[model samples]
Target: MYNLPGLTIRTISVSETNNNVYILTSKTSGAQVLIDAADDAPAILSLLADAQEDTDATTHVSAIITTHSHWDHVRALGEVKEVTKAPTAAGEDEIEAITVPTDIALGHGEVRSFEDIELEVIQLRGHTLGSIALLYRDPRGPAHLFSGDSLFPGGVGNTEDDPDRFLSLITDVTERIFDQLPDSTVVHPGHGNGTTLGAERPHLAQWKARGW
Candidate 1:
C-alpha cells in the first residue's frame, strides 16, 4: 500500500505470458503514465478506456515507459501509443522501433517527477541492455519499486539470456536497490505477484552463491 501523494498504481495482466502492465495516475491532476504494454491490442485498449472512464475527461496517458525492449515487454506498445497519443520512453539502448524520448533518457540515480510523486530511475541492466527499475517514495504510504525483469520474488531476473549481464544485474540489485530501500518497500515486478524487499533479502546470499 505505497500511497504517493496523488498517485494511483494499478496493474493489469496481459497476454498468455502474464506480463504485468502497470498504470500510474495522478488522482489530483488526472494525468496518467503507463509502464509496459505487453498485452494484445484489444486488452490494452479496454484497459485505457476503463482508466479514462474512471478519471476526469482530461485524464490522458502522459507517456509510455518501457522497462526494457524485449518483445514480451513491448508487444503492444505501437498500438497503445497510437490509441493514447502519448509519448513513449525507454532506455537509449533498449528502445525499439518506436519513437523514444531521447532528451529524457533515465539513467542510474536519476529522478523524474510527475505531478506530485517523484520516481528515481535506477539502471538495472542485465535483463536487457537498458533495463531499469523505478523507485517511488511517497509521504502517504510505503516506498514502491517497479523492478522490471531485473528482480522478482525468490531471486533476481533470468540470466540465461546473457550470463555476464545477469551477474551484473544481480550485483546492481544487491548494492543499489536492495541496499537503499527499506525492507518493507513494495516491489512490483514486470510479471507475477508483488513482493517485499525484506522478504527477498535473506536469500540474497543463496542467489549470489549460485552465481549467474
Candidate 2:
C-alpha cells in the first residue's frame, strides 16, 4: 500500500502470469480507479472488497483502465467489470483487439480524474500498438507511473526481435517519460517490485545498445 496526500495505491498480484491489478483510491472522496483486471475474478473481487474495508469508507470503482489488450492483462476484465459495473477505459487503438467492451477511449495526454486525483494517459507503442502508461502526480511528493508491461526494473517492455518496435518504445519512453518527469518518479510496473526513474536512468544507453 502506498499512501499519498490524496490517494492510496494498492497492487494485487493475480493469476499465473503474475499480472498486477492496481487499485487507486481517492482519500477524500473514496472514489477508486482500478488498473488492469488481469485474472482470477475471485482474487480481484477480494482485493476490491479489501480496499473498501481498509479505507473505512464506501468505495466504488469509477473505472477500470487497461494498459493494453494482451490476453494475460485482461483475462478477468469481463468478470471484474460485470461485478463492479464500472466503465472500462483503454487506449483508442486497442479497442479492436481488446476482448471486453470499452466505454472510454483514452489517448495521449488525456486526463482521467477520480475525485481529486488525476491520471495522465501516455500512449506508448511497441509492446502493443496501443499500450499505455498512466502518470499520477501528487501535490505533496514525487509522481507515480503505472507502466504496465511497458517498463520494468531491468529494462523496457519486451519488444521481441523487432528493432523497429524496440526503437519506437524506447523513443517514447525516453521523451514522454524519462525526459518529461523527474528522476524521483516512482514506477510501478505490471509485475514485480517497483523502481525509480533515477535508478534506471543510467542504463538507458545500455538498453538501446543491446537492442532488447
Query: Which candidate tops lDDT?
Result: 2
Output the worst ten-in-a-row residue range by lDDT, candidate 2: 48-57
Q: What is the lDDT of residue 52 in candidate 2?
A: 68
Off by over 4 Å in 2: 54-56
Q: Give the per-residue lDDT of model 1 (tens digit) for 1-212.
A: 22355677877888888999888777677777788888686876666656554556457777788888777888888888878778777766665433433334667787886555468888887777778888878676778899988899988898785768768888899989888888989999999999999999999999888875
Candidate 2: Cα lDDT at 195 = 98
- lDDT by residue (17-40, candidate 2, tens digit) is 888899998777778899999999
Clashes of 2: 0
Among the numbered candidates, top TM-score falls to: 2
- lDDT of every model, 2 decimals: 0.78, 0.90
Q: What is the lDDT of candidate 2?
A: 0.90
Error of 1 at 174 (Å): 0.6
- What are the per-model numbers of colliding residue pairs? 0, 0
TM-scores for every predicted model: 0.89, 0.97
